[model samples]
Target: MSLPLTAGETRLIVAAADAFFPPDGPIPRSGSEAGCVQWFERYLALSDRRQRLLIRLMLAFVQLAPLLLGPERRRFTRQSAPARIAFLARASKSRIYFLRVVFLSLRAMMTMAYLSDEIVANAIGMKADTDPFGLGGQPPLERMVPPPTPQASGVRLKGGGPAVEPGLGDVG
Candidate 1:
């Protein structure tokens, strides 16, 4: 087996992995298949501040996702394989940001598989057809929905209009 991971490197990798896989979907293969664990390990060892900044940005991006998407977060978290793979294929700066946060989160290493998927998907142009937020041609079900409309009561009884006076209807 390869040498053990350092504490900081392990922390970063785990965090990146957790955000990659939600509760549902196919269980990804090991770190060797993705090669990101190695990438991460090598990356963490470096003293570059840019990586640190990218990681910070990624964490904020992920945390904001919950608020920005709202109810849709549940569905996005359980996305279809195609969508999941598409998101993973791309390894852009955005992916790095995601990876950094997940690493910090200290989630399971298994989750990293999904991140690898996204990086790979992105590189192969899968992201071109799919938007990270599922905005681009994605099915309506996965898209964010407008808040429910407030029901309008035609009887306009605001400001105590005596709609329910003391003996209005068969008081016992």
Candidate 2:
């Protein structure tokens, strides 16, 4: 499905994904080639309006960050691959929590997009054997037990004394 992002925004996402998950080793395609942009588009489409807006804002920041933070003031998409990678690496180490969060979030998305491909999984010897019936072993959710909820106790006052009930004290 078509995403809500503008053309420029879409280009930026593609470029960012490519930079974050460049094709290497046995991998034959970059994140964008593995359909990262399409995955991101679908994800945004499924998200709530607020979430979509926040994701868009994050992408915008990622796209513009190179111009603001890099030694050379250039757009992220226009930067060379090495420059892009360096910018992201620096952002990942930023002292600002928001910058680090944004870098981590983008890295996660890029990794997810790149590694989720069946070809990549098979190439990495991680492809699961297909089971037509419901015989792929029990799902992990079936083994989980809900934890018991803790009961609330009355508040304790200072000095290690039991909490006094209001109006229950001796009146002299």
Q: How many residue pairs clash in each candidate at the backbone level? A: 18, 0
lDDT of 2 at 9: 80
Q: For model 2, where is the 10-residue window of minimal lDDT?
A: 149-158
Compared with the true structure, model 1 gives a TM-score of 0.27
Winner by lDDT:
2
User: What TM-score do all the candidates reach, one by one?
Assistant: 0.27, 0.71
lDDT of 1 by residue, 1-172 (tens): 2334555445434444433543342544333345555655554455366765564445345434434433334232344444433334432223457554553443333434444466555644544433666466856865657768664444446586635544456376
lDDT of each: 0.46, 0.78
Q: Per-residue alpha-carbon lDDT of model 2 for 46-65, expressed as tens digits?
A: 88888888888888898888
Candidate 2 pairs with clashing backbones: none
| Index of the highest-TM-score prediction | 2
Clashes of 2: 0
